[model samples]
Target: MPDYGFERIGKRLFAEHLVGGNFGNMSVRDGDAGFFIKKTGAYLDAPGEPVFVPFEGPVPKDASSEYRVHLAVYRTTPYRAIVHAHPPYAVAASLVTDEIRPLDSEGEMFCPTIPVTTGAPGTQGLANAVAEEMRHNKLVIARGHGTFAAGATLDEAFLLTSLAEHACKVIALKKMFLQ
Candidate 1:
């Protein structure tokens, strides 16, 4: 019933250039057992395979490096899916600002204010920071790293991921050409 469209969303992430090579990850909660996450080193376009991780236990050796962030979100938020990516514009904007207030309409309505937080990449600290904000925001940016977005389904999460990038792109462009 839940849209576990990992492969479909993965392809879109790749086709749209939101991710390049093996730069991002995705996951879906697997009831009380655990969650299924994209494997480390796997390409978003193909998404080699998904690794299952329990709510409490040793993680799979091949799980995505950002697995902790995904796990934390699943445990702390009501969202059922997550999509993480290093979209260029969003990552670039995050470098200079502590928060991103979308200059565009859709970003204004859907996201509006996305908090930018920081922690070393692939650590529990980063996971905690991201999960904490995701509880109150649709998406959170990790300083100069990437984005962590959650939704009831992968489709919804994927859309947020794209929206963040588009909105950030607008901000970046306007700042470059208009400001």
Candidate 2:
């Protein structure tokens, strides 16, 4: 379809280790047919060709298991881009707390408090939880799972994901030092 900034976002996510192997997913709304989502099992840092599926039609065989989450966000929110990843530190931090209170200044400003979602990774419950939080904030952490960030553009969504990871690192580091 169109150059939806997937390549750049993929590379950045991979380089930052926000995702590994075939983990995580990214998607962009394509006018009205539906959305262009990374194919199932494709590496987030290099999801070759995108698979565009109609919102009300059958999903392709290669679509991500969490494609439902992407669709839910597009249907309920105005955001056009979504980035889902299991940023190591962010996911780790979520395991210990329901909400990650960003201790760093940037975290405080951009992610004062990152909310966590509970449920199986690719379930509708998980999607609904993430979509609800996304209405108020651009990023959310799926407890013991990963992070889901959305924005008008892929760049904004990617940045929110990165910022969330950085904040998690700060929180983790501080905890380590204090203990």
Residues 75-96, candidate 1, lDDT per residue (tens digit)? 8888889999989999999999
TM-score of each: 0.95, 0.96
lDDT of 1 at 68: 94
Pairs that collide in candidate 1 are none
Scored against the true structure, residue 4 in model 2 reaches a CA lDDT of: 86
lDDT per residue (tens digit) for residues 1-179 in model 2: 67888888999999999999889999999877799989988877664898987899899988888998999888889999999988999999888888988888998988798898787888999888888888888889999999999999999999999999999898778878999
lDDT of 1: 0.90
